[model samples]
Target: MIRYAPWKVASIILGTLVAILLVIPSLLPVSTRESLARAAPWLPARAIVLGLDLQGGAHVLLEVDTPSVVRSRVEALRDDVRRALREDQVKLTGGIGLQAKGVQLRIPDPADRAKALPKLRQLAQPLGASLTGAVSDFTVNEGDDGVVQLMLTDAGIDARVRRAVDQSIEVLRRRVDALGTTEPNIQREGNDRILVEVPGLQDAQRLKDILGTTAKLEFRLVGDSGANPGDVEQLPYYKASEGSGTLPVEKRVMVQGEDLTDAQPGFDSRTSEPVVNFRFNLRGGQQFGQVTAENVGKPFAIVLDEKIVSAPRILGPITGGSGQISGNFTVQGANDLAVLLRAGALPAKLTIVEERTVGPGLGEDSINAGKRAAYVAAILVLGYMLLTYGVFGVFADIALGVHILLIFAFMVLLGATLTLPGIAGIVFTIGVAVDANVLIYERIREEAHSGRSILQSLDTGFKRAFATIIDSNVTMFVAAAILYLFGSGPVRGFAVSLGLGILTSVVTAVTMTRMMIALWYRWKRPTVLPI
Candidate 1:
């Protein structure tokens, strides 16, 4: 135990030095740490981030509007069925309409039903890739009365809901990240709800406003279908008084925001006003150019969430596929619109069923309480260890300190969040850290009483206590892993700290303590152990 190789000693020193460097910055003020990062980019930049429970921010539970999703899907499917029938030239019309679970079309003639059944079955395409080619999004069924029903598969709607939830989570993450919020927790709560916890967020209403809007931008032509030219779709604009005070946009969308490649907030050089400049992707650009070229003198509406943001006439063909949305918006509004366009629209509407805000004062008090508890635990553990054993106890205490520093260092490296329960885990680690030392010291006393030499007894004690330490720590590690796998939120955070502390404790207690003892022994050349 006393004869450590030169490289091993150097490695231990390096590890301890690295831990000090990484952990010290976390204990410093934010400004000071930022300055240090600027000065030395080589050092670790990530610090311990406080969780929502500790930092205090916004908490919102949003329920996905599944009914809206279903209705939209049904309407789109109904249109597809009508188009398919027209293309196939299977004429037996009562017109396609929505039913309880899907769409239904009346084929009045019984003779035409056979022709339409095969064509409608052709429309029942596979939902996605399948090895068996068994499941489809829709099932075509023919009734005795020649009424063909195109019913949506249960699997398809469930799949759609799952996709919507996943896409919503990603979009929410992008929106929150755009707001410069740190370590926001966005997760799905159930089949139809999402839970969002943002740390250090100040303006909850601003975030809500951003999330509330669907931001589904569409470009549609303004025209009338009948001889008198009746309005196609009446859309709302930002103000109630823009071009007849209502948007008379054709329901047929020419282009959509999904085809957008980029959107930036900028000022129009001619008007010196804030505007949102948007560029379309290749397919979108081609379609946009084609539409503008066809309707050179017609007005087109830019609709957002059923509201028209702008209505501009095609003065000329815009072949470049880039345009600006100018609605006399302020700089901030333009920036926000640009962000919304860039993030894309949510799949469906989200209703904030639950909203919560944790005040900064409560967070500060929680932090102080955690700190106090930790300090008290450390003081008690250190005092107990020192009273039980003399110089050996001091060595254990030093190792315990190093163990904690290393834990913080690992936490920083992993970018783990520290919650209130995680603080409790750290306090719990204090006692666990000294367990190995106590085992080793007790074993050493037993060996010394058995009449072994001081050096021999120390070596034998470490070797004998090693197995017990491994068994205990491994069991704790397994428990932590189980907790992490099954638990959520704060429980996961606690598992992280506890698991990391166990590993760090083993190294510090077994290795660092032995190293210190070995070095002290070499200097003192004592015939008897200090303990």
Candidate 2:
């Protein structure tokens, strides 16, 4: 058997006893709890409670509605295509993009295809020039006799998906941020789905409801300008609003918020009026400047979501790139407007597939259960190590203590919120980590029995076992990382903590433990081991 000096044996035993002592206060009063939270923050072997998956809670999966989003975008494209073709005097018959493909038209004569195909491509110019520049991508394939076909490209569909997904993600982020919840996990699932998990959320329905709706706002000019009186000769650049909800009747807007660079709810420094201040970009500023300059002293509507909110006559050129919007708004109303403006308009609708309430009561019980399991598992591991290896078990336990410290320090550094599954992952990790120590100790015993000296025995034991430990643990860590990348919510929690544990375990069990043993051997030079 391998030999350890009496001092080395005593020191290992003493250190483990002290670590156990340090953990005792967590069972005591509130004063002790606060003290423990701050003590030795780097390697807290303390048990951190987890979420429902660890203790016991329901798991929910969300499916994104992609078809709905695609249809909405196609419909909008159809409208734009029709309007542009009519404006260009292209006699187009039948459907637009949302129909068979992107666009379709029955030419009056076969020769019309020559002029129509090229012009239709131009009409679809807003789609982008890169794809349509080539006739093959834009396509005018002859149908049997003479009918030509136009179809949307795969690249165009991919482009639309990307835009829709981006818009959905931005809106979701706003809704979640406003909830004031901690560590809510939200991520894009596949090309069209969004995955979100809120810990300690008793009622998740409200969040889902808020996220699923496509709240869109649009500004459109309405009514005939002929009936309107005032500056018929001057052509008052501002049109009066003709609709409702911030959109003024008989007035036209000089500029809309889409051209804005930023919007925020704030009080006017001079007047203290609750208002939304918006600033336009360079191009938008120029457009606004031109519009206001042309319509000086003429009415203009400030519209939001197809409704006219304000109608004010243009005074002069607004070239400062910024302006204030003040209405009969409370602070909350202004804040809401700011939020809506910042989030912009949703590109496509989200249809909810699943939603459920996760009560706080359910969450608390999970925390209690996860903590209990962790404590029980830790005790079992400690007992097994001591009983199996006798004195060397104490050394393994010390290394394990170091592993726990590094793991907690890592979690705190990353600001990772620990769920119950995460705690279970840590518990499972301890089992794997302890196995490495068992392998090393058995190797050490083999070397000692072969009549090697104590120093020589340890050196050979660590060296022989190092390769196996590194290779096995590294492979497992890789698997966990892959799962975390693809898995949602608690599965992700499991992967993150498990992966972290592997790194911490390798350092403590092999390097740090060996250094301590090597240092002891140099000073003591003992002849026999306690085990």
Candidate 3:
């Protein structure tokens, strides 16, 4: 279709531009990433929303255990009540029961209620715990028979939920930041659930795994599982792990998951088997050596959640401030376990309530939409140019083509994500770009009609049009900069397009298009311009 095409040099340039567009973004090197960010100071390097699927990151939904929070508060209140009663020397009988929303306590006599009233106020002062719907001014309204009662005021279950939510926000913030990921998206989805999204993550499961580990490191004696209470006492610590699981007498562990500074997977020196080796720092090291020294030759089990992963027989005192957990493991499996242990365990458990993976179908759909939009815009721009300038419209189209090709190369070179929105921006640029060339062409036409040589007309057109083109493009560039500065997600994408459009349009209209005109003039210096 392209007969008597431009010089081999021009074709090479065009081909290189196309190749860059087609290849670069997909294979963006780390160095190029930084350079692009540096080059386009307007297009921010940060503040872009990198989806989980595009970046291979993790996402998590955390549901706060509100019931536990409520109960814990109630129990603390009960403790305060008991302490206040003791302080006031009130004869308190029985204990306290937590009902659906309120608490009921058993007391001896109505007279005792009066005696306990002052102490109750003192204790309730700190509770800040309020009553449900009823205003708990807790008036000590004594009946005709001198009967008194404790009542509640404003605050209730809702208040507790609010406090819990606030605390949860703080804790979750700490947890996510501890992970060392880039600005993670942690937002409250509803009242109880928190949604977290992380980009450039290696493992999504790591989120659950880290959040799940209770991190409760405890050490108890692992005695014979089959032993009776007396037998457990007689059999010592090592025998407990021998029988366990279903009805076996479980032994308590003496040491726990804590007290470890570093852990890693390594081959056992004596036997070429995989094992997790861990070492303790200053304080833990001293404690570990003391424990082992006091109980030399005694078998201790390495238990995880009541199940024994391994229990190597103790031979002499391990005074080296380090230990190994040997098991039958492949190299990769061992390494993964080591990494998990090193990061420490999670505080609360997490469940995967929802999952949506953006597969290739979505990617393809985006690509199709983007291409369609671009095609439509390109067609309209070409048609308008053809109508406005007639024959020279073809030249503008060629220049427009080169402009687009260069933009793609620029996107690839800069590692700008070719998002569907990004595609829309690129397509939109095509239409806006022709305005620059239109100005120059219109100027040239006016010059040619005024009885000037074609050469003089061309010179006047470019020289006069350059100022107007620069002025208009500078405003657009400023607008794009502001949009990018404040916009997020898709809005940011539009800004990126607008900003980049100004630069490429100037280049294609001024330099590339001028080169084309120069070649055309050299080949045939027509007396009158083609237009």
Candidate 4:
């Protein structure tokens, strides 16, 4: 082990020099770091980011209403069936609406029953291609009362929920990234919950505001039955006018936010006020044009999250696919709306069920405590090694320091987050790193006592101890890998630090320490070992 080739020696020296170079930027100021990055694009410019527990920030637990998404799909299906039956001129009786776990519609007339059954089955969307044919999302069945039932299949519901969760995660990532918080951690906690941690965030409330808003936008025509108490479909909206009791709007949507292609915060040229300007896709633009052209004198409500934000009259056709939404909005509000529109609406609403804030002062205290612990541990370990092994102990201590430097170098290169537990990992690593050196030195002492020369003792010690070191560090590495794969948040940080420490410890302890001892041995030509 002590006999290294010329190329191996050069490589080790080069690697150590590279580690020092890469780790230097992390310790420097931001300006110097940026300058170094500009000068050398190959170097890792960014420092290790602190975690939420270490840097202090907003921690939020949001529960997504996944059931509500399923319910809304059922409701939409009911509406579509009603519209389809009516448009096909099929006579329908009894209520056509959502039932326990499916949609139910009655065709009392025997003649129309057969006709309606075919039409209802036609509305069934194929789940995917199959050997027999397309698999439908719903199973159709007829009852003795001439009622047709469309029950949603279990596979359908499962697929819907899975898709909703996936889309929600993607949208949440986009929203958090839009906020420009540094190294924000957004991940799904369970089937219906998301955990968000934004480190170094000062305005947690603002983040809450952004996340809370569902930002669902739609356009519906203003209803005619304004004051009628007997209207079932016409619900009253207070924001339509001041003290107007209520301004009814249609239940059907003319344009959904899914059709929106772009949205930006800009000033309306005519009003010279902040507004959210939006554009739609080709199909949406055509539909919007036809609606506006047909109802030139009619007013339509622009609804956002169940509230009528604005009701504007159709003055002309908008064939350009672009329009402006002017409301009682500040510049910031308009910008926020634009951002929401651009990110697309969430699959389901998210309720902030739990929230907490960790202050920077607490993080500083944690960091200070961790540093003190590390310092004390390092001092005791260094003192013990020196007292036990003399000059050889100093070589081990130097190797230990290099082992730490390499860990930080890897952390920066890997963009690892540092937490309090990560500090614990490092301190634990300090002890473990020295343990390998201790094993080798003790083996050398044994070999020297057995009438072997110093060179023979050193070679035999490192060679025989190699297998034991490999076994111990390999086991540690496997445990850390498992932890990292299965664990979350702070546990992951610990795994990362611990894993990196294992690798660096192995490298520095085996190669660098032996190299240093070999140089010392050659220079002194010692007849007896240092210990």
Candidate 5:
């Protein structure tokens, strides 16, 4: 165990030096690190990322709007029902009646009801594949007097809610990423809630505004003065200066925002006002061109989140697939809208249930407390090792220092976030870093007392204690892995640090300490063991 090769010794020394260098940037002041980065861009300037608890930022808990989800699903079901009846040539006594859960319609003729029943049943698609079986999204039921009702199933609503939460998470992630914050924590909390944590961001309100806006954009024709009341609805005009009242717009959508391929913020050429320029996909472009060609000289409304943003008359067919949106917008407002359009709309509205801004002052206090705890841990551990074993203890103390350095170096390389619990994990690892060394030293002492020679005792001690060290570290590593896989937030941070510390401690305590002892023995040819 004490034997070493020339390359092995050189490699060990080189690795120690590299680890020290990797940790140096993290130890430096922020100003110094920035200056170094500017002076020499090739140097490793990346440091450990601090978690929200350590570097204080925004914490927001948002809940998906259930009612909005249900309403949208019902409206979509109504459209599907209308299309199915028109395709089957079935006559209805009244329009498809909208309900909170689903839609209903009455087929006055018994023959038409028989024909429509089969067609409407086909509209109830399977929600998703499940272990139990394929579950339909809607149930078609026959009522009295040739009336039929299509109701959304409970499982279907849950499935839709789950999908909305998943899509909203991705959309919110994209929007948050555009803000250029580092290491933002965006994840689902419960079935309906999403928790977002952005470290080092001070603009809590801006984050909320960007996240809360549904940004559902649609294009539809402005209803004619004599249009049927049922075909048009009064949507509030978004422009306050023009009028605070409503504009009558057709219920049919000409184009949807989902078809947008790109959106950017720019200034209007004629008015020099801030605006959002958007381009559509191939299908959307064709639909837009067809609509513009059919509705020339007619006004169309640009609607956003159920409100009319603008109503402009179509001059001619626009086949270029690109258009601009002009509203009473400042530069920032235009940019925000462009961001939302590019990110895509949320599946449903999200209401903020909880919001908090963590100031940097509390983070500073936490960092200071962590630092003090770490310092005290190192001092106590080093002092204990020194007093326990004479010269051999010094080697163990040096290895412990190297272990700490390796932990931080690994974290920096992996871009791990450090939290308060992570600091506690580090301190705890300091106390255990010398466990292997202690075992070896104690075994060596027993061998020496049994009248064994110094070299024989050292070799026998390490070889005998090696298996125990590995066994203990392996169990701890498994525990850390489990904690990391199942835990969230601060628990995850602690797991990361603890896991890294375990691996590093094994390397330093076993290999490096043995190497130091071997070199010391060769140089001094000690007649008696230190312990």
Candidate 6:
């Protein structure tokens, strides 16, 4: 135990050197690191990412619009019911009746009701698989007088809201990523809300705009003079610089924005105006071609969020699956629209219920405070070990320094975000790091006083304390893992630092310190052990 092979000694030296090199870029100034990166592109230039709390950014809490989600689901169910009845040749006495939670219709013939019952029941999809069983999204109820009601269950609504939140998170993530920010935290807060944290982004309003836009695009035919009143509805038409007015449009959607595969900002060749160009998938392309081919010389409306952006007549069949939208958009407006289209529409509307912006000044103050606390902690730990253990204390202090370097190196490589709580975790671990050394040193003192030789005492002391060290560190590591798994934001940051510190501390406190002592003993051949 007192001796190490030459390869082992060489490995220790090489590892420490590599860790120092990895941590050096983080310690350097941003400008210096950038210069170094430009000069030597092969070198690693990554530094530890600072969390929102330490870097100042936007914090937005958005709640999914439950009413909108329910309304959408009901409308979709109405469409499905209509399609089912038409396809099955089961005639209804009246139009599909819209309800707050679902739809209803009347089938006068008992045979038609019997035929429609199974068809409508087929529309009820299984929500998802679970331990107990799968539940249907909606229930089909048949009442007397041939009246049938389709009601959405509460569990179904809850499940839809949950799914909307999940999809919204992904959409928001894509939108935020387009801004070129680093390490944004986008996660679900609860069943119906999402919490977004963007580090180093001070433009809260822009973030809100990007997140709030539903970007629901649709294409439908303009209502002709002879069209039925119930088949058409008046929607607001948005004309640039001309004020908004109403235009009658058909209710049937020809194509939806979900079929769009890509969107880009470009200029209109004829008018030299900014526009958004979009390409649709094969299914949408086929539908679009068929509609345009049959509707030549008729007007079609391009709608976004129920507002008409443009109403242009179908000149001919556009078989290429690509089209452009012109609405007198500015360059920035065109770009923003393209981004939204590329990110895809949110499953439901999201309202920003809470917003806060952290200023850089406050972030700077936090960073300084954390540095002071860490410096004080290092000084106290180093001074205490020196005063208590003399020359051996110096060895422990060196190991402690190496442990810190290893922690920073690991964080840099992993790209972990450092928060104020993370700094506190590092300080707390600094004190905990030397506990193993304390245990070993005290054990050595006991053995030497019991009349064992200095070499025998050192060997027995390390072996005896090693198990206790592993047991305690393992417990702490498990606790850190639990915290990381269940906690969010700052708590997670603290857990990361604590978990990493535990790993490095074990190496430094046990392996590195023992190696130093072994080298010292072999070289000096000391008569008495230093206490």
Error of 4 at 415 (Å): 1.9
Q: Residue by residue across 369-398, what tens digits does model 6's lDDT show? A: 999999998999999999999999999999
Say which prediction, candidate 5 or candidate 6, comes out ahead on TM-score.
Answer: 6
Full-model lDDT, candidate 1: 0.87
The residue-by-residue lDDT of candidate 3 on 1-531, one tens digit each, is 012246744864776456454544344666775787789755434323334434445667677665655565565666666777677666644565554433556556776777787767654443353343332322233344433334333354445555555555554555556667765656666666666766556566766655544343433344665667743432222224364332222344455566777787899888788888988777777767777777677666665444445656567667777888765667866765565566554433334576433454555566666778888888889998888776577778987887776666666556554455666777877877898888999899899899878888988898899999999989988888898787655566677766787788888787666766766777776777767
> Where is model 1 poorest over a 10-residue stretch in terms of lDDT?
222-231
The deviation in Å at residue 298 for candidate 1 is: 2.0
Task: Give stretches of model 1 more than 4 Å off.
Answer: 125-138, 225-231, 239-244
**Pairs clashing within candidate 5:** none
In model 3, what lDDT does residue 313 have?
57
Summing lDDT over every window of 10 consecutive residues in candidate 6, give the lowest-scoring window.
127-136
Question: Which structure among the candidates has the greatest TM-score?
Answer: 6
- List, residue by residue over 59-128, the lDDT tens digit for candidate 2: 2345445565555655565666567556656664454324544555565555655665666566443344
Query: How does candidate 6 score on lDDT?
Result: 0.92
Candidate 4 clashing pairs, residues 3+ apart or interchain: none
What's the residue-level lDDT of 493 in candidate 1?
A: 87
Best by lDDT: 6
Q: Can you write out model 4's per-residue Cα lDDT over 1-531, one digit (the tens) per residue?
A: 445677877998888788888788767988988898899899777787888888899998888776677787788789778888887678877677687567988888888887778878887787665576555678789998788888887766756665676787788777778877778888778767788899998678988887877889898888787544433144345542374344578777888888999999999888788999999999889888888888888998888888777788999887898898887688988988888888888888888999999999999999999999999999999999999999999999999998998998888788888999999999999999999999999999999999998899999999999899999999999999999999988899899999999999999898888998887887788888889
Task: For each of the candidates, give the backbone clash count.
Answer: 0, 26, 17, 0, 0, 0
Per-residue alpha-carbon lDDT of model 5 for 407-481, expressed as tens digits? 998988998889999999999888777988999899998989999999999999998989999999999999999
Q: Regarding lDDT, does 1 or 4 come out ahead? A: 1
After superposing candidate 6, which stretches have Cα over 4 Å from the reference?
269-272
Candidate 5 vs. true structure, TM-score = 0.94
Please give the lDDT score at residue 232 for candidate 3.
47
- Order by lDDT, highest first: 6, 5, 1, 4, 2, 3
Supply candidate 3's per-residue lDDT for 7: 77
* Candidate 1 lDDT tens digits, 1-531: 779778888999999999888888778889988998999989876778998888899888998988887887888888787887788687766677787669987887766777678877887776675465555777888776778888888877776777788999998888888878888889888888899989998678977887777889999997654523443866666653534467567878899899999999999999899999999999999999999999999988888888877878899999898999988788988988888888999999899999989988899999999999999999999999888998999999999999989888998888888999999999888899899999999999999999999999999999999999999999999999999998878888899999999999999999998988888888888888777
